[model samples]
Target: MARMPSAERRRQLTEAAIRAMTRDGVPRTTTRSIAAEAGVSLSVFHYCFDSKQELLESVMTTITEHYVAVVRDAIRPRATVRETIRAGLQAYWDHVAAHPGEHMLTYELTQYALRQPGFGHLARRQYELYAEIYEALIEQLAAGMELDPSVKVPVLARYLAAMTDGLTLNFLVAGDAGAAADILDVIADHVADLFRADT
Candidate 1:
């Protein structure tokens, strides 16, 4: 068999690890299981990644990047800040509704990252990525609507990050999409009010 390039093999191992972790639970997943999932030898797994921890970090990155695309693509720019906020948030909720497993896996990995030694940084960086995505979305909305500079982009980004996290957890636990979405709609209005320069 022909040998796979480093990058391609790395991607394969990362994706295989994600599946193995998702199927077996992160704590129970083993390098052997991951190698089986990848159809690669144990040596290949070790060659592609230094350790299981490294492979898991890659899995976290992969999942994060996946949802970033989902959330970004769902949001539609609109005429007014209220419309924009509502559109973006509703689209976000819709994505969560459609991909509950993906969202659940992300939160699970976050908890795992938080508990592991030398891996807590992954959890922190996950939120940082969330904040960055939110900041970019806020800037995009600002192009069409005037934002209150005093409120600050980072502040609002963190606020949205927290709100979405809580709402997603709530929905996952209660399966109450209707209530969560309604509350999110209200939050969208309030957030728009806070940032709206016109009002």
Candidate 2:
């Protein structure tokens, strides 16, 4: 048994749980450990998150929300689609580079979701949303150019996304942020080329 915690305290605990998850990973981030790390009682942890899965879901939502908000905020009304996408990519690169542990945790969740159909649905939903955003960026970037009807817009989006994800994976493994930038520049050039291609 533990003392009741304030709402602010609960928020703090949740944030601490996120930090712990980032640092220790999914298997290691138990409620007791989080409570201890947060300087709160076990009851506080229970009161805030019904279960470890709930806590992880909240953490995932929080991270994704932050990523989406940052990209949205960086959007400029006068900027062209490529410019907006460049800004978004830079933001994502920076965010991922800064939070490798959290990213590894995300990958772990994705792997776990592979075995759980319901969770896989959640993953697919998120994937669709992200894909749609990137597809819109691609469409806007190539607004004046005609594309090969055979090359679906969704396929382009997936390719662009794969390029970014590949760079991210390289950075994660090699720990080279500069290499990630160079890779993005290369990807951007390729995207431009695609946009310039004749129908």
Candidate 3:
């Protein structure tokens, strides 16, 4: 019989895996490296995840869920919609500044997903998750919006999410998060105006 993992052990392993993959990208991320990074043996990796594919999938899912939750929690419902949006975007900036390479794993995953059908599903799931966050923010702030009825809220949300992701990526590439931060407020304000015009 296999020994069950304690909660702490499980979390430590998962987090170690996250750090390793994020830092080294998927091609270089091996079970052995992950095990060493986590201060465990190959057997421990096998016990926690059935295969490398399974572990990769779980790591991506974990990263996606954690980032999504951070975006969701960026705003308080009680705050003004504009404030909520700013808070959320700011949280993202902070996250990126702290974990630059981490998102590179996501970018790499995005590229992989774009080509492979299996990973493509993960990419689609991530887009939908982002759209969901955007929708929530718009729905909270946008009432009687004036854009084309068919695409109004969703369109706004898509643009905002897309722009936010783009800016994050650009900052990472340029190594100038401060430069990006300077423009974020203006962009958010513009987004607010774009959607709130009809409200």
Candidate 4:
């Protein structure tokens, strides 16, 4: 295969590691398997990442950025807060449906990081990242609508992050897009009511 730039090679290795972990689970994943998946040699993997943990950390960052971008792209400046909520939530669900394997791998990696030595911080950082993204989105939505939220942005951000995580886990296990859609409607309504400016 033709050689790739260092940045491209690093991204390839990170993506390959995600696929490898998803296919084989964290316990069975190895640098050899990740390199094979990336169509590169073990030495290339070592050149790209000093250790498996480092690779996993990069994978987490990559996935987080991808997920955030999906949601951000889905959101639009709607005339109504309810419409905005619905669009954002639907976009998120669509992303989940489109990339189930990657989402599953992300959850698995979270558990793996939590249980591994010197890696629990990664899991915490993951949630913090989510919260930050959610907070920013919420702020943007509020600004777009010229409204102020009843609750603080940080609290709302954490609540939405936790709610989305639970909703996603349920949808994944049940494979019930209909039920998830209904739940999203409820969430949208709540968000609309909670974030609307005082009458």
Candidate 5:
């Protein structure tokens, strides 16, 4: 294989780990398997990740970034705040609808982390990343649209994160696309109502 920077090699292995974990539950995915998936030697995998915990954290962060990029692009100041919010939510929902397996793997990772000794912090970090992403998105939207929210940004961010997390899991379990879309609409309207454009 051609030589690559350490960061590039780590990203390659992380993506491979995501594929492996998503296919074979997190508990089942081993560093050897991730190495094989990435077409790299086990030594290289070890060189990149000190432990499974580090790899899992990287995988969770990458998975979140996948959909976050989509939502960020979709939220770019629409004609109205409601339209922008709905676009962002729809973008995220579309990702869940399309990649159910990947999203399911996120929940599995959470459970796997929580149950594993010395790995509980991974689960907390995963949720923290979710809230942090929402907080950044909220700030971005507020700044772009000159809107002030009734609720503080940090609180609203956590609320939105929790709401979106639950809603995604509900759709994953129930498999109701129509109902999910309706709920997204309601959420968009409710969220839009919470913000007022600066006069």
Candidate 6:
């Protein structure tokens, strides 16, 4: 193909890798397959990613960004904190519902990384990334709403991350959109209660 910036090329390859991995399990996806999926030469794939581990990291980060961006935009201050929180959670739930395969792929990636020798760090980093994103989102919501969280930001962030993680998996397994929506309402109410006026 015509020349493109390295960053752009990497993004193209990363998206292709996600498609390949999401379609074929992480264990089955190979760099060569990703190259083909990206419609790029093997050399180009190698030029973009040094190792499969690096590619996996990029894929994980990209996948998280996909949904986090939606939630970020959905979380703009609303009539009430509960509304804002519910909007964000609902945005995330919508993403999970629409892309259940992709969400399932994330869990598969975590398991694949953990079971692979010397790759455990990838799984840990995957989780740490989740908490980090939640922390940033929490801070954003607090600042936007001028609210103070009863729990520390980091603690609250991790709790939210864990709650969503479990809830997403539950939805995937149970395939119950109505039940998931009800749970999101509960989570939004619970999280909103954890905040108060900043003053």
Highest-scoring model, lDDT: 6
Q: How well is each residue in 62-105 modelled by candidate 4, as lDDT tens digits?
A: 98787788778767777788988889888888888888888888
Question: What are the per-residue Cα lDDT tens digits for candidate 6 across 1-199?
Answer: 7999999999999999999989998888898999999999999999999988899899999999999999999989888889989999999998998899899999999999999998899999999999999999998888745545356889888999999999999988989889888989999999898877655
* Model 3, C-alpha of 47: deviation from truth (Å): 3.3
Model 4 global lDDT (CA atoms, 0 to 1): 0.84
lDDT of 5 by residue, 110-192 (tens): 99999999999999999999999998999888864554535787888898898889999998899998998898899899888
Q: lDDT for model 2, on a 0 to 1 scale? A: 0.68
Model 2 scores worst on lDDT over the 10 consecutive residues at 75-84
Clashes (candidate 5): 0
Q: Give the clashing pairs for model 2.
A: none
C-alpha lDDT score of every prediction, in listed order? 0.81, 0.68, 0.71, 0.84, 0.90, 0.91
- Which residue ranges in model 6 land beyond 4 Å of their true spot? 144-150
What is the C-alpha local distance difference test score of candidate 6?
0.91
- Please list the Cα RMSD from the true structure of every candidate, rounded to 1 decimal place: 2.4, 4.8, 4.0, 1.9, 1.2, 1.3
Whole-model lDDT, model 1: 0.81
Residue pairs clashing in model 3 are: none
TM-score of each: 0.86, 0.70, 0.75, 0.92, 0.96, 0.96
**lDDT digits (tens) for residues 1-199 of candidate 2:** 3555566666677678778877887677788988998897797678777755566566666666656666655544334445555676777777887777766766666666566645665566555666776787666555566665667899888887667667766777899888778777777556655544344
Question: Where does candidate 4 have its weakest 10-residue lDDT segment?
Answer: 142-151
Please provide, for model 1 over 102-159, each residue's C-alpha lDDT reduced to its tens digit, 9 standing for 90 to 100.
Answer: 7787888899988988889888888898899899988877764677767888999999
| Model 5: per-residue Cα lDDT at residue 186 | 91
Clashes of 6: 0
Q: lDDT: which is higher, 1 or 5?
A: 5
Clashes of each: 0, 0, 0, 0, 0, 0
Q: Is candidate 1 or candidate 6 better by lDDT?
A: 6
Give the TM-score ranking, best first: 5, 6, 4, 1, 3, 2
- As a whole number from 0 to 100, the lDDT of residue 30 in candidate 5 is 85
